[model samples]
Target: MSEPPRRNDDALTLLAVLTDDASRAQVATITGELGDRLLLATTIEEALAHAAREPIDLALVDVGIDGGAGLALVHHIPALRHDARVVAVAHRADLAHGADALAVGADALHLLPLAGDTVASTLAAARSRRLDARERHALAAALAAAHTTRRLYDRAMSALAAGEVSSAAGLFLEGLVAGGLAEGLALYTALGGAAVRVAAIGSLSAAPEEAAALEALARPGGIDGAYAPLRRDGSLVGALLVSGARATSTSILDLATLIATEYAAQRRARAAMTNIDDVGPALTTEEAFLAANEHEIARARRHCRRLTALVLRGCGESSALAVRRELRSSDLVARLGPDELVLLLPETDTLGAATCRRRLERRLRGLARDEGRGPLLVTSGAATFPHAGDSLAALLRAARARATAGAPYVALDRAVHALPLGELVPTLARGTLAHFPSVAPLDVPFPGLLALAEQLCVEAQRAGLATYLATDHPGRNLRAPARSLSARDARDAAPTPEAGQRDVRPDRRAASAQGSSVELRGVAHLAGCADLLVIVLRGEHASWAASGRLANDRFVGVHTHDPRLADLLAERLEEGHRRRNPESSP
Candidate 1:
């Protein structure tokens, strides 16, 4: 009937150690029971040699190989088959060595006085790790996947632009599967605020009214799964829902969950873009774009003209804030890098995109000249769709091409990506085009916050006061605040950060410390400062510091503890404010 299923080539190939026939029998017995393949080696050197020649997925190291040296000899296992999952063999007295074995990457350690059950389980775990090893066919699959992704991405863009959300979702789901997960895939959508299974596969038992159940689950109560709402600017389009699968590890699940979440955002975006095409009984520009490539859209890659890469630079804090102002929940924009982002503009072609690029460049240049500040470069470029081969790589390659072109920004084509909007946001921000908290925005004079920020920094630098400006996220993830406050004080904190929400300057806050503030990512980049002694508050309330379990402030009688950011917050805020004032005459 059907062709035999491909072996899970990713399966573990086991290597067992032994001297006498008894251990060999145990090895064969365990391997057979585990349904794993085996390779035999009598001595440690022999095992190492065999493993080096081919990929040995797991190693059952005989710690007492020559009837001695338990933990010491196990070190050879890691040296030989470095990536192999190991299970250490030990004498009953060597049971303590099990902990040591595991620390060295041994999946599990088995006692010499082994029970059949313990041996099997350890082998099974090794098998699991082997199968899940992110390195297995990762490189190859990743490479092969690289090709289809661009086409898929273009397809996604096309579908979204044409208002074919369902189709675009299919592209996303399939592309994600190709990206890694062997498991079947599905897509969920936000219908009336609830993330429902708009599409799916591999769903095993009966799902209980998934749409309605999911809607209920999204509310205030009910198991209350954390909703990391996906927001572009500040609009809540839909949430990225993650369901737990007991089959995978937490790390694996989280990564998979995020990937799944991205599909949701892309699908929503595609749907939004496509709708311009479907509005009935009207001669619409959206319909024209859709109609141009009607047959070719179905043909997939053939109809698409050029696939261009857009590289948006100078988008630090100020740039991000400006972009955010332009983006709405209904219009999806995903952050691909700290300062780089991808906007899937559907159907708009390249020639047209170039015109749009020029328009944007003119505006930015005008602003830069008017402000008499730093040069702002946002450039874009195009690589023909199939010619560039339409994937993330293709897009990236296209983007890389334009990077050296001396343009601040570039676009492939306007019509290919930009669906003619009924009405675009009049401008990113209003009244004087002042810089927001993003790195850089329109630099015309406005009510200045930068002056205050500058003053604070001068005061701090003059007094040699260490300052640290607190950020909501982008920087929050960059710097994890040191926790010195107790649980109750943190939990009862009030005056929820309203006034602090108004971002002043662009991304100018930087963490300067003689201390150990520099972390895994590097120095914190934002507006603010910190020192040992500092004052803190929320809105008009003067937050008092806590001393030995005694909180000294009452906020409108709510009695909340000072925020964890208490120490240098006032200075950080003031520094950030000073940076926003154009009149400060930097």
Candidate 2:
């Protein structure tokens, strides 16, 4: 019996991995009669190569090929082509051979002197099974996509319900991007008579002004690429701008409407709350402070602004009042405990917070003297956003730790230890290079420092850590030449290379050849020590800094795990760079 010929699209492609001439000829004849394609492979490599290039519907394996190696190919065929069926062809019907074939993922076992009718029936059944498997696989993918979409929606809604409108917008944009609805999205709220972007995700090239103009002109009915207007009670409250080939304007519009409604309700509720004025300057309640802190943190993250959280212990009402008076009206002051106060300073980096702490300490000391009290010991600690910590809890914990320790910088200085340049370079590079950003001594005459710095830069780039390299020797190349170096040359050049340092040189070459994302800034001069090299790495989860000044071939500067120290050094380096190159872009 002969099977009917299949149409062009329905035709199956069969792979026959056989050493037997008879079996190969039989497979070719069967495929020819069935109107299907047959690929002949004598080795496993050839069969895999054929499957890699094109789809294979079924595979026939000669169990005796290469002394049983062909059986292993049956396991791999299905992996390469998910729906490909395998049949083991044995010289004779042996129970052991049949069991071995079935154990290795063969769909069926066929004995030599194969019948054409049996082969045709097996091919038809395999085709049916392949089609069913493909359908099931597609259905599973669709279900997974739907589940992901629903999860993202629930998370965004939860943020919205928590009164975090900016966070909600960010979460929603992330969800849309994750769900393939948009490549980029920006959420704009009507603020101070213009559309202001509150949150953004992915690659959006539209300028703030352009986004605002687009929001102003956006209408209810627009194309998939156009802005979606957010309206509440017929009044336009905000807008959503999405960019991508897969952008769904209708879904975005509905989400915008829901967000706008919730936002309007929140605004009305806030307006209805009664405002109370205190007779004297006082700290804000912890609850109110936390709420405001969260809002400020969200704004800071959105705008790429800096924020500082300071914790001061051993402060009385008089000292608290002094702190409140010393701070700007925009700063937030709240009592965290009976004698501890927390201050939120927006647009403040570590250095700014340190300066504020010094000023406040002086004011408190004078107040204590005037009140005829003993020397007031007010210990304070400060942590900056995107540096010391990203969240309130993290920032508070860092700040509290610093306050408990005497002076922040003094404590950091105490932690610093002197080490040989050879030892220090590898120690810093190998240990916590990824966990913390680093600052190294760059002014050292040692050539190894430059190589180590370059190696660290490459490692940081590979690890996805944002790196900043500053040096007084701007003329020196930070990266090694893009060529293979001998083991002796590497050792002589670096003295103490990091573990697997040789393996990562290719990454360095690629990074340099590709134009590394690591920021390199050269100043004509550096404050403190011209030989000082500062390596700072900033990451979402952690920050690290190592600043070393070479003295008598020894690195004798501070290295701290404290992110504030790293941030402070980074800020100073940036400031120095700006002073040296006034017109250059940062």
Candidate 3:
């Protein structure tokens, strides 16, 4: 009915060819309901021009135009627009002319001034044909592409089976060639602490940090034309970065998955063997964790004991050891990878897990201090049983998504109510490691957010804390000079972009020395390293879960309405810092 309301951004274009004044008037009466969607062309030349520039869906041609040369136009419509449907019309009903129109590839031949019912039925049939033709063409193209991909994929699989391919990189290159790509291809492999280039065909190169960021985006699923993560057993090991004009095909993604799976199986086989001799009774393997988690989940279901799963990423082996030492003997611990760990906390509720997290944060911070490194930046997320998930894999996925979303802790508690905006700031200080300021439905203005950030930065500096005020706003109209904010001296504070400056660093890591508060823009790479990261969720870019994954400490959320909110936030942060390091109090 009425063209199904035009289907959001997919309005159809109809070209009406009426050479005479009388014909124009009659055509207008039939298509007046379509309004601007109908394009009127007086001549065949004008009709062809419209077809060339716009995607014409349907065309109404009167063969009586240009001394009946319109019959010739009917033959050329297929060349002009293969997808467009044509309805040939005449001033009066002439069976001979209608027969000729039908012979010349016209979908329908109608006589003008006919009954409204006849016109509607004839046009409906033409539109149906147009749609059916489009679907057929699309299906044919997709089938052809799939056939080509399958052929290439089969060859790659054959090579692997025949021992012709040796490395993961080589397999990846084969995938690219299968996808009809020979240039501008790069492959990055996640090697524990960082991402390394595994293979390259063209001059394209992505930095280690860029590769890491790309891998993060690919975890849930690969984005088109960007990168695809190589996952095995539901964990990310590396990613394939696609650049330039070559879009990633489904076959390419499947090939990457196969390669990753092969690699992981080999590694796990070796690890499983070594664990029998090397692993102590205190810690377990991923296989053990799976069995134990399922068993505990069943026990919890029967006895009603609470269970929680915590996943930690980017933490080194030392951190993992420290975590094992701190955990109770009853707790189940397992290694996810070289830099990842999973802990199953039995007989623990969300609140208990949270308290444990805070204590561990303090201990880890102290450990980092002793090691003379920035606080061990660990991105962790926890999910509870029954509420978060019923199975181990589901729970792990939920936690990983929350962790990736930058949420400090995500509870699958379907019953809990979100805190109000007014109390969110305070609750953030007490419970969460990172806070996203609550805003109303009416979005806050950009200037208000900048003002709030400035206030927070000033307070941070006054408290003897190095502050970084990073903004991803496109303009260079910051409060300070628009240049890199690298520290010049140990005690030097993080710099700010000067007003009226033209430089804009879309992704910059601005850090202060001891008690550093690094500011970051769109830099997902620096998020894990920041002692405190302040994110201003403005407009549609607001994604709080992603922000939590970046900050090492709990982030603070502020509102534009409260001018005094920043001062209170800074005071609470300082108080918390002092409480953590009471022995260092001056």
- C-alpha lDDT of all candidate models, in order: 0.42, 0.62, 0.52
Q: Which 10-residue window of candidate 2 scores lowest in summed lDDT? A: 501-510
lDDT tens digits, residue span 1-586, model 2: 1234454766888888877777677777878877887788888788889889878889887776676777777788889888788898877634466569898778888887567776788788877886787789888876776678778777676566434565666667777777777777776666545666666677653525323443554656532345667776787777777777465667667776666545544443343222211113444455555654566676567556677899988788888888878776446677767788888776566545655775686688789889988566677888888878888888999999988765444433223223323334344434433423343323444465555555544454444323354444455454242111222223333223323211222212112112223455554364444566566654323455666655665444545546555555555566567777888532
- Model 1 segments beyond 4 Å from truth? 1-11, 33-35, 66-83, 95-99, 131-586
**210, model 1: CA deviation in Å?**
46
Best model per TM-score: 2
lDDT of 3 at 30: 50
Q: For candidate 3, what is the lDDT? A: 0.52
After superposition, which runs of candidate 2 have C-alpha atoms over 4 Å from their true positions?
1-13, 18-37, 42-57, 64-84, 90-96, 111-164, 203-224, 243-255, 258-586
Q: How many backbone clashes does candidate 3 have?
A: 14
Better of 2 and 3 by TM-score: 2
- Per-residue C-alpha lDDT of model 1 across residues 151-250, encoded as one tens digit per residue: 6666665554444455555665455455443344434444445556544433311222255533454567533233334333444433333333223334
Q: Of 1 and 3, which scores higher on TM-score?
A: 3
Q: Model 3, 1-586: lDDT tens per residue? A: 0122232233356677765556555545555543325677878888777778867777878777776777766777667787777778777644466568889888887776455565446555656666677789888876776566566566556444322233434645644554455455556545444555555554353323344543454454533335667766776666776656456667666666555444433343334444431123244456655754555565557445456788877667677778777776446667766666777776555434543554565567678779988535666767877678887787788777766764332231111123322233444434342332443222234454445455554443443333343433334344332122223224564245334222222211111112333433433223222233334311111111111111222233323322112223332333434455576453
